[model samples]
Target: MSLTVRILIGLALGLASGIALAEWGAAWEADAVAIAQPVGKAWLGGLQMPLIPLIFALLVTGITQAAATARGNRIAGRAIALFAMLLLAAASAAALAGPLL
Candidate 1:
């Protein structure tokens, strides 16, 4: 079978097992807590581990590239101007909605 089929089967099996455990109050239920909670925490930690360096690398690369290209400042300025316009539009919409409610 293909990988997609295998993944779907695994998800179905997992859902079935979870429902069975919930019904039976089995060891699998307890194991789910023990396994899932720490694994989830560790997975989140793993994700966070690379975030700072990745963000810094991306930012530095972007800035360096922008500096090298003359249009970087203009692009950044336009982005800021567009963001300010959107913020003002959002605020105005909210203000108009508040009085109607």
Candidate 2:
């Protein structure tokens, strides 16, 4: 199956399991949380591990290319403008989703 389908399946199973454990296994709640905490943290940490270096590399590459290209200054300005607009759009999406979520 596709990655998206797998993710959806995993999400559904996770929710079902969580709900079952939370509602029917109250006594195990604390232990369950404790046991799961490290896994959650590791998942988050793993996701963050490569982001900084990847972002830095992208920034450096963009800078070098912008400097080397014809009409370099204008291109850099346009790139920054586009990047800002993208960031704004992403922020808007998160903002819009936050309240609904």
Candidate 3:
């Protein structure tokens, strides 16, 4: 089978098994947790390993592009300023609301 089909089947089986365990395998909960915890951590660590460098690279690229554009024209500078203001406002809102959440 193709990789896409294999991935889909794996996802379906995982969801099904989790639901089954939740509904009818209460006694196995601790065992499942014991087995899954390390696997979950490893999975997340693997996923995150490449993302830090990728995000930093993208951020650097975006900043350089934005700076170049901003230097070239008044309209671009204003647009970049507006974008920065909006970004700051959104971040501030999230920070203010995060504690309540």
Candidate 4:
């Protein structure tokens, strides 16, 4: 199946199993945590280890291209302006709603 569907299925199964274990598997909880903790940490570390350098590379590449385009292209500049405004608006909305959440 597609990656998206596989991810959704995994998410649903995880949620269901978590709830089942929480409700009826108290005896297995300690063993489950012991098994899951190291695995989860390793998974998270695998995901995170390359993120900083990847993000820095992407940002450098994106800014270089954007600056070059925005310098001579009015349309690109205007589009970038609109993008920035929307980004700021989204951030502001998130900040305002964060406390309520």
Top lDDT hit: 2
Model 2 regions lying over 4 Å from their true place:
1-7, 71-101
Write down the TM-score for model 4: 0.51
TM-score of each: 0.57, 0.57, 0.54, 0.51
Least accurate 10 contiguous residues by lDDT in model 4: 52-61
List the candidate 1 regions with Cα displacement exceeding 4 Å. Answer: 71-101
Clashes per candidate, residues 3 or more apart or on different chains: 0, 0, 0, 0
Higher-ranked by lDDT: 2 or 4: 2
lDDT of 1 at 37: 97
| Candidate order (lDDT) | 2, 4, 3, 1
Overall local distance difference test of candidate 3: 0.74
Q: What are the per-residue Cα lDDT tens digits for candidate 1 across 1-101?
A: 99999999999999998788788897567766997898898898798666555655565566557756876777755655665566567667866996699
Candidate 4 positional error at 59, Å: 2.5
* Prediction 2 global C-alpha lDDT: 0.77
The lDDT of each candidate is: 0.72, 0.77, 0.74, 0.75
What digit string (tens of lDDT, one per residue) describes model 4 on residues 1-101? 99999999999999998998888889869998999899998898799667655654565567658878667456555655665676567667876996698
lDDT string for model 2 (2-101, tens) is 9999999999999998888877888768987899899998898799667655765586578667677765877776776676677567667876996698
Model 2 deviation from native, Cα RMSD in Å: 7.6
lDDT of 3 at 58: 62
Clashing pairs in 3: none
